[model samples]
Target: MLDLAYDLPAPKVIRGALHDWELVIGLEVHAQVSSKAKLFSGASTRFGAEPNSNVAFVDAGMPGMLPVINEGCVALAVKTGLGLKAQINLRSAFDRKNYFYPDLPQGYQISQLYHPIVGEGEVIVDMAPGVARRVRIERIHLEQDAGKSIHDMDPHMSFVDLNRTGVALMEIVSRPDIRGPEEAAAYVGKLRQILRYLGTCDGNMQNGNMRADVNVSVCRPGDYEKYQESQDFRHLGTRCEIKNMNSMRFIQQAIDVEARRQIAILEDGGSVVQETRLYDPDKGETRSMRSKEEAHDYRYFPDPDLLPLEIEQGFVDEIAASLPELPDEKKARFVTEFGLTEYDASVLTADVTNAAYFEEVARGRDGKLAANWVINELFGRLKKDDRAITDSPVSAGQLGKIVGLISSDAISGKIGKDLFEIVYTEGGDPEEIVEARGMKQVTDTSAIEAAVDEIIAANPAQVEKAKQNPKLAGWFVGQVMKATGGKANPKAVNEIVAAKLG
Candidate 1:
């Protein structure tokens, strides 16, 4: 078993009129499976298709159209379970969660409630350097997504787009281990990163590929500990479900506002009511949507259309073996193998594409130097241009060459920056450009000593000041570098300058 223990940070306390309160948050993240087809239909799961173009007979709930489960979605769900380190139930069943909505053409959603596909996993959220919180996974159930209802296009009528109908979603439910708004956002982010790395979900919140329903409740400081000591809900106050929060910023904002609202209610001598609510970003408040539904409310029953799903141990083993190195494992390897700070490793490994790019650039080069160039120089430039790593002008091979040049003392650090700019704009080999442009560092002792001697002789008064204060020696080194157009080897320039000044 993985060590999921870490020091929990101080709870985010909300000062109420009557009593101070602490936030307890849990997230139900709905991640669309990265499959081309829908869960139980043959329709294409493309996002921007014409309305109803992607709908199948079964998806429309047409008469006598029995649902046939898609094998690909099941495989992806199992893959997600393995990625989360969750238990994959060999025999899991699907049930119909009966609900009525205009977008839900079937009048019900096929989801797992009793026998979830995955069970009992934990997510270790890295809150800070050496500080982590273990958020337990209650279950991950496979379900079909409802079609979208577009209301704003017309004032008098609404339109339904069935592009997302019957789309497979893995409802990743977490235990209420999150104590604050920021941690809530971080937990979702970490979960999204893991999902993206697993190739099971795209984790694109904007595209509606992923979204979270946050369960927020407020309690007194010691109440949370009491709830933890004994598995009881009385200690943890009634939680309101904030529905369909896509943005991380909004997720945090909603939690804070909701917690404060709950505190305000309790202070006013009213008990909190459990309900489903929607977060209005513009108003920065949550409004009640409906009373929170329980299992009996949903009228959940086993789906007669589909049988119980059973998989062999070999099947699960195959997926586990095929699993790529996850974010946490990759981050740990980067810190140990490359001697990187945990912060740097975390930044690099936050995205799978960025991590791959870093690995390629650091393959044979000095890992620390490569990381510095990639993070500071390359990433900074990319950000300035409003570009992603994939759209970066400098390729990994080009960056690796630049780092190699600096590592081998073929070019000074300053010269390397200039080379990076030239390659980023014009595009060429780093070494060939250095040679063609005469950008190689002046490492020869004779040339460097001559330059240093000239600087010291020209600035006798400054040299005396440098001899008095050792820090003043940097002026002469700067002069030497300027004289050589920043091509002088910095180490060699410093050595010569110090000797001549002394």
Candidate 2:
């Protein structure tokens, strides 16, 4: 059981003709397991292969093709369960989910229904600095994915591609704790971050490697609390499952539209129906696909071809020992160790590669300074170029050297930026470039004072006005820095200008 006292943002209220309604949302995320072969065959799991070239005998559901389980996929699922802080079931069974589709050669999906591999887990979704929502995981079951039915190739006849058939998937289902569109999206994003950090799934939605089935419903205010206490579905309104949303933006939009649709129906004296719906991105609305099916509708039964899966306690222990530092832990460490704000720590730890690069730059240096440079300077430049951190032209070492120069006051912040450009485009050591170009700051008191005196003499009227208004003294400082070609130390220039003016 999860603590219900955690702070969640206010529910998104939809105004109806009679009363306001709130959104209740849950998610079923299908994540493709990271593996080299199919779950029950030796076929390659590589993406973008020739239409059916990666299909094996069992994947095509041929006669006398007995299914053999792939151990790698099971191990990845166990790793994911451990990463989620979930209970890993040592003994689990596979069931046949009866379904018929053109792309489903076997006519049934091998899934875990009664006995799942993972049990209850919790995901702490950070809404703001100190606000979070705890979304509970109902279960994570292993299943085989169906293939694709391509209709765009030929209008008269559709085509079936079996490359994706039999690929392992972990259906991570969450309870109805999400309150709004934004919260729903954040829940999915947080889950994706964890899965990516665990190296269980790539979480690539564009390639169809990961997608979500969003269950959305609208209830009157105070009904959510009643449902929380009673643990009954009556308090929550009837839910409609939106199928296969691949994009985060689309997921949020779909939920909002669906909630409003439900609200409008109930306000118009129409009771909401339980069913499955599909979201049309361009249309920005959901249309009915089919009536929601109960468990018996699928005719689920245990598979006799494969025996129940049983693993030793030592197996779970070994996998637990090998778990990596997850995103939340890493973010907390970044905030504590680096003295960074929660926002900065979250941004830096969003991606594993980004966090690693930042650590390398911050090692043995001022962490706050290093974070500023890495987040603002490096990340801004990379975004402008449409480049990932792994593909960055500026290496961590070079960026660290630039930050070191700025910290040591060897170069002004302005000069540091200039040095950054030279090193980024021309590819040279930051220190060498600073030395070769003579771009060091003009920290010598005599040089700065002479420059300040010359500026004051050239502008006598401005100097008199500056004496009356000390704030206007910045005029002389700017002029001196401009006179020195922006290489003069700003602190030194300010001090000399203020003394001479006084």
Candidate 3:
């Protein structure tokens, strides 16, 4: 339950020749559960194994090999449900979804159709600072992933790799609550962050650990409200499912293109047909793959090989207790506790590793100063080098000490940059480096006064000009800092310079 019922303007609307239209989006996100073994067999779920090497006999659909459920996978699904604030069905059953493909060795995907493990949750998508929309969760079902079919490996013959066969997946289906392309992307990002925070899934789209099937449709504005009140889906129009979208940019692009395509057909006095489609990013359009299939088309039936999955209320409570603090909770805490702006908190809490690093650096320290150093200095440097927070050369403890030195005026900001560079390259103590290299700020008023006096004496005309125009007083401050070998405390120098000039 996100408080996103408040009215907000729709950002994406197609101004068709006949009328205006808005996009409706729903996502069926597939996330690979983080476990050491496959869903039904103990085959290694590790990535990048030799082709077909990680296959178990059951995963390969060998004759007489019966599938057994992995207990850890079940726990992960339950944990994810609790994290999403959804209802957990203590007794849920699995069904066989009949399909045929080269990647599917068993010619069917074992999924939950009649009853899913999780239901009726909502995700609060941060569209902008202090602006959000809630996307309701329809269901989450656990299923086995198919193997990979490589067509380019050999031109004469296609190759199949069973390494990913029988891997566990949580298909999180969202209600068609999204109103725009950007909202759709934001919704996906929010789910990915929650999954990663819960440790249920890694959410690595590049490696195919998580992907989304975007269902895009178009309808008029008031029609959506009518459907909302009546709970009728026809007002939303025919939704085409865009399959296997891994890139967020591509998701947005596909939704826009697909919506316009549907609008064109409707405007031409032709009815829109529901179907499965593929987005070609190169061509910037969606091509029809096949007619959309209903649940009956899959011929779903209770999986006879496995019994109905039944767990006690105590088991559900146990997994619920083990759930981690999700993204929204963490982001709120970061803002209140650290005095960080919503945007800063959002950036810091975008990933689990970044949030942990920021916390370690900001603990018991000036939160604002720590945030500046972590975001502006450390993160800037890491981004420059194209490295991740986990690959940071400056450890959390080291970065914390550097911020401490700057806050205490033990070192000026310039000297802090120097110290950071030294630690980043050679790796050493921040305080020790400041002391060893004489990077400490010259807080002694007399020493700074003497430098100011010398600089004034050397440039009499310039001192007179500075006194005439107070704005030029900073010139004397810079000169004094240089005379002190860039060690003068800037605030003290400004004070003493103004006094001497007056």
Candidate 4:
């Protein structure tokens, strides 16, 4: 986590009338483990269930009910830790995080603070092509999620949904390594990618499966570095937490809005308060929720019902062995083996499904052509249609065939695009479509030469201009393609046109 090999940028300080202020951010991301049962109870952890239908007696905090730790949840936490390259603590205990909320019938949330299962991990967040930042993970602790308290259900009263009660959560806490709003979002995105790859957490932020509590603080120009060297917390200024951020767009917006609010306070000769705040994206501002509490305030103590978790190194090794080729490794392989650009590889490998699709499409084909079609044509259409890669109408095999045809000069790129459109909407094989519609490229050099001669003879004026300026020769190729109804191989047409003009 504290590895200093990365080329992380310095804190981006903004100049003001009084002084330059640097933004310091840390995120506590709570991701729900993708298990069927709750953390301690046998209650189903299914989403959108009836208000309390998924609750077990233990989850409902019935009298005399005790918690039994779920081994699956613990295994997931370890798997996630390994995915992040973190230390897995074989022995960790659960503590009661006492707080009063209607949704939490138990009156105390089971969590780990002093002894966390995972520690000292780092996530590499890609800011741009060939640029990244390594945000340090302080610890990842397993905890029980409190249920939902819905305020808009009724006019006079709020409704409580205990279905989420006792659900398992991996609260991944990070150090204050993030410098900007975009970096914070990138960090979260990268972490979510890793978790999804591990199959531990689904990384679905919109469904309350994953949410971030962002801690933001402001400092002077050199204060960030000073705090790093001295290991002091106060140099970073008083922090305000924006809670339950679910969307990347809103996350960046909340940080910027909060930073400006803090700046205004400091510029007015006022001190910032340490409190929990909520970002209202609709209103474009943050409002106070409650004062931030220290660990002592929670009266955290080891839970009596749950025993200290103990595991063997062999368990960790097994999980590590089962790990998939993660996004970073896959991206590197795509760039090295497929000759893809850094940006294209990053975009393609950002999601598991997208990467798999691209891999299949690029297999034994011209990797560059496949990447271009996937990144530009297929991805563009999916974005326009509001669809995921999994929802794509054109399968990987179908798209790969399109690229193959283009590579083999069996069809021109124009015809290949037409073939893709037919497969996406109408659904058919690229080869069959080309054959059925007489769309196969005329790669025969003699046929292309005859078409070029006919076009050149008819359009003598354009040919004379093209010969004067060789760059204008593109017009001759276009004319030949148009004469052949875009069925002629573009390369062959270009060659024939160039030779005739010469």
* TM-scores of all candidate predictions against the true structure: 0.97, 0.96, 0.97, 0.96
User: How many backbone clashes can be found in candidate 3?
Assistant: 0
Flag the better candidate by TM-score, 3 or 4: 3
Candidate 3 lDDT by residue in tens digits, 2-55: 222444536478899999998888899999999999999999999998899999
On a 0 to 1 TM-score scale, where does candidate 2 land against the true structure? 0.96
RMSD of candidate 3 to the truth, in angstroms, is 1.6
lDDT of 3 at 477: 91
lDDT at 167, model 4: 97
58-114, model 2: which lDDT tens digit per residue? Answer: 989898888998988989999999988899999999999998899999888999999
lDDT of 3: 0.90
Model 1, runs deviating above 4 Å: 1-5
lDDT of each: 0.92, 0.92, 0.90, 0.91
- Residue ranges of candidate 3 with Cα displaced over 4 Å: 1-11
Relative to the unseen true structure, what is the C-alpha lDDT of residue 502 in candidate 2, on a scale of 0 to 100? 88
lDDT of 1 by residue, 1-502 (tens): 1233497655899898778899988899999999999999899998888888999999998989998888889888889999889999999999999989999998999999999989989888888886788889999999999999999999999999888989999999999889999999999999999999999999999999999999999999899899989989889999999999999999999999999999999999999999999999999999999999889998899999999998888988988999999999999899888888888999999999999999999997799999999999999999999999999989999999999999999998888898999999999999999999999988899998988888888888997888899999998888988998888899988888777766
Point out where model 2 deviates above 4 Å. Answer: 1-5
